[model samples]
Target chain A: MSNDNEKDWPLWEVFIQSKRGLDHKHVGSLHAADAGMAIENARDVYTRRGEGNSIWVVKAEHVHASNPDDAESFYDPADDKVYRHPTFYTMPEGAKYI
Target chain B: MELNEALFQFCLRRGDDTHVLSHRLGEWCGHGPVLEEDMALTNRALDLLGQARNYLQYAGQVEGKGRSEDDLAYLRNERGYVNCKLVEQPNGDYAHTIAKCFLFDAWHLPFLKAQLDSKDEQLAAIAGKAVKEATYHLRHSSEWMVRFGDGTEESHQRAQQALHDLWTFTGELFETDEVYTTLQQAGIVPDLGPIKEAFDRTVNEVLAEATLKRPEDEFMASGGRKGQHTEHLGHMLGEMQFLQRAHPGAQW
Candidate 1:
C-alpha cells in the first residue's frame, strides 16, 4: 500500500547483479527522493534474501525504451532470419562455457 | 559478580538491546510512509532479530543453564531485560523513529566493532557478523535523518523535536557499572570511552549535514543495565511474550 503523499517522489528502476561477473538484470521499480535513496531502496526491496551482491538504480524517466506499439516493425523481421543462427557452427572439443 | 555471571549479564544486555529494538521496528511493518520503506524497516528488524538470537543463545550458554534462546527471550519478565531505554521509546512519527534509530545505530556500530576483538571467540564471531548489519543499519537511518532534517519546513521541525525528545535516552548507551567493569577487566569487552567518542563524532557529523542542532544531556536517563526499564517495556513484552506464556513449549 502506498500513500498519496509518497507519489510525488520520483520513480526509479532497480537492477541487481547476482554475482561479481554477472550483468545487473532489471528487478523492479520503486520510488525514491534521489539516487542514493534509490540504491538503498533497491537493496532493501530486491536484495533482502541475498539476491544480489551489487545494485544499480536509474531514474525510470531516464530510460529510453523502444515503443511497444512498434514491436512488429522493430523485432518481427528478425524472426525470419534463420541464417543469423550461430547453431550451425561446428563445435570444438571441450569448449566448456560455450 | 563471578566471571560467568558477569558474562551472562553482558551477553543478555547486548541480546536484549537488539531484541527490543527489533520488536519496535517490527511495529512499522505495515505502517511505513511508503512500501519500500516498510520493507526496509522490516529487513532491519529481521537483521537485528538474527543478531538477538545469536547473542541470546550465547547468553544461555554463559549462564550454565539448560535454557534455550526462546526461554531467555519469552520467559523473562520486564525487569529481566537489560536494553537501553532508547530502544523502547515509542515510535512517534517517521522523524521520531529515524531519530531513535540514528542514535542507537551510531552507538551500536562502534560497540560491535570493539567487540570484534573480544577474547571470547563466540562473542567475537557474533560481533563480527553483527557489525556488517549494523553498518548498513546506520547508513539507512543516518540517510533518513539527513533527509528528514533538511527536507522541508514540517520535516525539519519534527526532526528537531525528535532529537530533543530522545536525547535523554542517549546517555544510557554509555553508562557503565559492574557488568561492564567485570568484562572490561577480563579483556572480554573494550572500553566505553572510545565508543562514546565515535558516537559523538557520528552524531555531530550527521547533524551538521542535516542542519540540525544536537541536544544537550541536561537530564540523562539510566538504569537499564541493572534491569531497570521504563513502563513501556512491560507493555511491549506483554504483547511479545503472550504466545509463549499462554502455551509453554509450543512449536510448529
Candidate 2:
C-alpha cells in the first residue's frame, strides 16, 4: 500500500501452546486488521502443520519489556547469585514434586 | 435420465461448482490486499479444490468409462461443466470477492450438511468431511462481509454494490431441475426447498446485521447447472487445462 492511500494494519505477536499444561510459547508475528484477524492469521500461518493446540495473540504495542540498553545492569547482578540455582539441593529418591 | 445417470450428473454439478469457485479463489494467490487475507483466501481455495477432487473422483467412478479425476477436471470443455453460474463470475474487487464467497458459503454449509444424509456412501462421506470445512468457510467470509458492510463509508458502499451486482447469480444455486428431481426421488439428494428456506434465513440475518438490504430479485442468471456458463469459465478452463493437455501423463 502507498503511504498516501492505504494505511498499514497493526502488528500482532503470536503465541502457541503445543500441548495442555504447557505455556503458550511465542511463535512469531503477523499483521492483521484486528485482534480477531490476528488469531486467524496466526493459525493459518503458524499452525497449518498442526504445530499448536492453543493460540494467543496480542497487539505488539501492548507488550512491555525491559529496556535493552539497561541489559548489563539489569542482568549482571543476577549472574553472581548462585543461590538462585537449586544445584545445592539433593534429590530425594523418586521425589515427584522435587 | 436414468437414476444412475442422474446421480452422476448431480455430482458433476457439485464438483464443477467447487472447481470453478476454487479457480476463482486461486486468482487471489498473491494479489490480496493483505498478506494474511491472501493466505486465508488461498487456503479456502485449496479446501475447495480438495472437495472438488473428491467429488470429481467419485463422478469418474460413476461414469465408469475409465475417466480419471484429472481427465474430468482438465479434459472437459466448458459447456460440459454444470457448476452454478455464480462461482464462475469474476473476482472483481476485494469486497466483490468476499460478497460472492459469503453468499456461496452461507448456502453451501446447509447444502453439504444435507448431503451427509445421502443414500450413497461415497457422497455421504464426502459431504461429511466437506461440511466441517464449509462451516469454517462460512465463518470467515461472513465475518468479512459484516465488516465490509458496516466498516467505513467507502467499504460499506463497495460491499452493498457487490451484493447488488451479484444478487442475480445467487438464484441458480438452489435451482432444481430434472437432475435434482431424479436424485431427490431416489434419496440420492435432499429436497432443496427447505435448504433454500434455510439459506434465506441465514442470509437475511447476516445482511440485516450488516445493515445492507437484500437486493430485490431483479433479473436472475441461470443455466450453468445445464452445462452453460458465463464467458469467463471458458478462459479459466483453457488456462487451467493447458499444461495437463499439452503434457499428457507427464509428472515428476
For each candidate, what TM-score against the reference? Answer: 0.96, 0.93
Clashes of each: 0, 0
Residues B196-222 of candidate 1: C-alpha lDDT, one tens digit per residue: 999999999999999999997799999
Best by lDDT: 1
Residue-level lDDT of model 2, residues A47-94, one tens digit each, is 878899899999999999999999999898999999999999898899
The list of candidate 1 runs beyond 4 A from truth reads A1-7, A91-98
In candidate 1, residue A87 scores what lDDT? Answer: 87
B45-157: candidate 2 lDDT, tens digit per residue = 98899999998999889988898888899889998988998998899999999999999998899999999899999999999999988998998888888898888999999
Q: CAPRI band of model 1?
A: medium
Whole-model lDDT for model 1 versus the true structure?
0.93
Candidate of highest TM-score: 1
Q: Clashes in model 2: which pairs?
A: none
TM-score of 1: 0.96
Model 1 chain B weakest lDDT span, ten residues long: B59-68
